[model samples]
Target: MPLSLAYAADFPSFADTVFILPAGTTELPINAAADLPEPVRAYVASQLAADEKLISINQYTHHHYYVVAEAKKTADLTAEALRKAGNKLHALLKTDKIPELFINDLTPDGALALAEGIALSAYQFEGYKTDEKSKKTPDLQLITLVGPQLSTEKVQELDGVLQGVYLARDLVNMPYSHLNATQLANRMQAAGDDAGFQTEILDFVRIEALRMGGLLAVNQGSPEPPTFTIMEYKPEGATNEKPYVLVGKGVVFDTGGLSLKPTPNSMDLMKCDMAGAAVVTGVLTALAKNKVKLHVIGLVPATDNRPGGPALAPSDVITMYSGLTVEVMNTDAEGRLILADALAFAKKYNPELVLDYATLTGSAVRAIGTEGIVYMGTAEEQTMLELKQSGNRTHERLVEFPMWDEYDDHIKSSVADLSNMGKAEAGAISAGKFLERFIEGCPWVHFDIAGPAFLTAPDSYRGKGGTGSAVRLTYDFLKRKATV
Candidate 1:
């Protein structure tokens, strides 16, 4: 079940309570301190004085618990730091099996950040588990923010974003057997239905009629057909005249086509190849749910790249939706192929800005492990700066790489308009250059999210498997745009 979050005017009488305070504070809330025994209060004070970050007082005899989470000093506190602290507290509560809890909203932003962490950390995917008992997740389901600073609107916004993130993670973690191209499109349609967005899914015949050769080439191998999903949210009196376009590569499962990836490490986790699609879907869902007054459109080209019948092969030249021919130098480089079609299709909207996200290259993962995203773009400097700021604020950090003309030269094909794969050097940048061709000089940013999109093990609040990497970052950026 999804975790529930609400703003409480007063603390609950019987539920465990958490005091979220800034570091260097020596005292707890008066009412809370009054409830605790004098000795325990002194112990908490001593712990705070010693700069202990978390102090837990478990009174098993009384079946009550109190936790003091001292966030960073006001001067040192960052959005990311507070979130990390919230993740730690979540772990403690889950281990103790606390069913419900109240957190003192001493600091408004701080409280919200902690709540974001706790809610995100509560996600689990055990849908296929046969044993009902083994499928149980954390009992920390209800979280109430108790303080004057929090508002109903803020809590609702946070809940909407959390729902989007959870949805993204769930879709990413699902195996291709359960989530194929058609199913992925169906899920997006369902999300639009629930979140009040408009969804138009272009079926295989429509895709072929549109002459999306790149997507068609990749889908030739799979028994299932391809789908191009377009989702839009435009409220009355929106902020932008030209809608912001977000495109995601939706290779539901990538076996590298005829180039067949090795099963050991490369192909085993291919279910996450569509993480970019998940992020786009998540962002749209959040924006619609929160009623952000900004016109935004989402484009996703989805299909699995398998080495089955008539799979794409090297030296095969294919035409994209933009009518530009691409020489397939390496079939493993299939992400840019489908994304090329989507970016080209974005031209119909005459978007103010276009941002494409994809697990497009391994060079990106090697350049900067799973710690950050690798991006290069043609967007204006101010736009890029604002995006980077949003990324830092959300902890989905970005590293901008140079998109010089020199990199574009690497993708120039002898036979086609461009080559899908460039020379091994600067593989990530070359992939960006390949997609840049389809954008046709429109302002655009390309994100190579191969690194942070999926994790083999849990990492704090991000958890194991699909991390929902860029969903929060993109949503934050668009949210700021709406406010402006």
Candidate 2:
């Protein structure tokens, strides 16, 4: 259970009341429902129904109920309630059969955690199993309460983000044989359509016409064709809200081209190269799935960085959409090259804010270990504070690094406008700087989720697979921005 909402009256270990509720039960009073704070009350009344929507049920094992209160829902309460309810819900499931339970009638946060639980529990990438020995994962279904009124907006927002995370993680966990570039594009299109968004997969002809150098050059090494997937989300009633644009580097598999990586496990996680695209695609999915009143544009520059006959070389030069040329210092630094072109492509919208996520460098893992995203923004950085607040709110985390001018010289190229990579001193920063070149005249944040995107073991509310790291952090940012 997530401890964000766990409280002492029911769950002793958790100091807050964060937990999940089961399906089909009567409305029960919480032990301390009467003593809730003014803000919490407003959160509950506005986000959760007093007695009409969900009966603020007390601590009970496997008990779920909804009341018939005529009221509105708020975002904060929904988030808090879901966490509080999840703690209790998990406790109820201890040693018992994992129920394939789904929920309805939640405020935003309430829905957030439920969606989180869905994404958390839906992790299964049993690709290389010679013997099929299976047990059961907690089969949980969620039916959220969203409408014109009395519904939590942020909860719906996070729900879309969670869906995107599930899609990405599932793709990563799936066997590579079942997921090539074309297959990835098809799935991407399907996700966009299902989630109430528009998806477009640019074929090689279109990509070539647009000069998507990084993505095309990288795919020259693979038999599979490259794809530049674009998904857009536009809500009918949303107005005056600047669209949030996201770009993900979806190198479906990175063989480092001719400069192949050493070590036996080098190729082990290659399938996850598309993780960045997965994040944005999933984010768009959440936006569309929840019918958010926000405009979002997602760019996925997807390709396989494999060494093929026409693949990029050690010292190739390619022009990006921004009209800047990059010397391929190392073909392995292909993520940034592809990102540069995509970032430039997204500038047409002049997105109020542009964010990019990529499994860019290993040095990021060396910096923050494997539990947080390595964030790099402008001199007047803000995501650090935002991420800290989000950590408290949604639990996904990020650690910001200085994007100072001192690192500028690191990326100074000898040939062409710049090089795809720079000195080895601060690889993460160099990668960030490389991407920063693509994002100009806008509020931009770059997240290097080299670590924490996937986990080796389980802990707290996460399990032994992709943790769906920034989905909640991004949702919290959106929620905070939305309410303000």
What are the root-mean-square deviations of the candidates from the true structure over C-alphas?
1.8, 9.2
lDDT of 2 by residue, 1-484 (tens): 2111111112222122322333232332354244455565555555343233333432334433332322226444345445444444554444333333334332322434543544454445444555545533343333333222223444444455655666767776654687777788888889877988888889889999998777777888888888888888887876436777888888887888888977466777777777787778777776677666778888887778787687788888888877788888788888898888888888888677888888889999999888678887762446557756785566566677888888888888778888878787899998898888888787788889878776667654556566566776776676565555
TM-score of each model, paired residue for residue: 0.96, 0.76
Error of 2 at 68 (Å): 28
- In Å, residue 145's CA in model 2 sits off its true spot by 11
Score residue 50 of candidate 1 by CA lDDT. 76
In terms of lDDT, which candidate is strongest? Answer: 1
Residue 119, model 1: lDDT of 85
| Residue-level lDDT tens digits of model 1 in 1-484 | 7898888888856558777775457777676665678888888878777777777887663223334444444422366776777788888888788888787766545778888888888888766988877778668778888878888888889999988999999999999999999999999999999999999999999999999999999998999999999999999979899999999999999998999899887999999999999999999999999999999999999999988988888899998889899899889999999999999999899999999999989999999999999998999999999989888888898999998988888998899989988897999999998888889779999999999999998898998998899998999999999889
lDDT of each: 0.88, 0.66
lDDT of 1 at 387: 89
Off by over 4 Å in 2: 1-94, 98-161, 379-384
TM-score computed on alpha carbons, candidate 2: 0.76
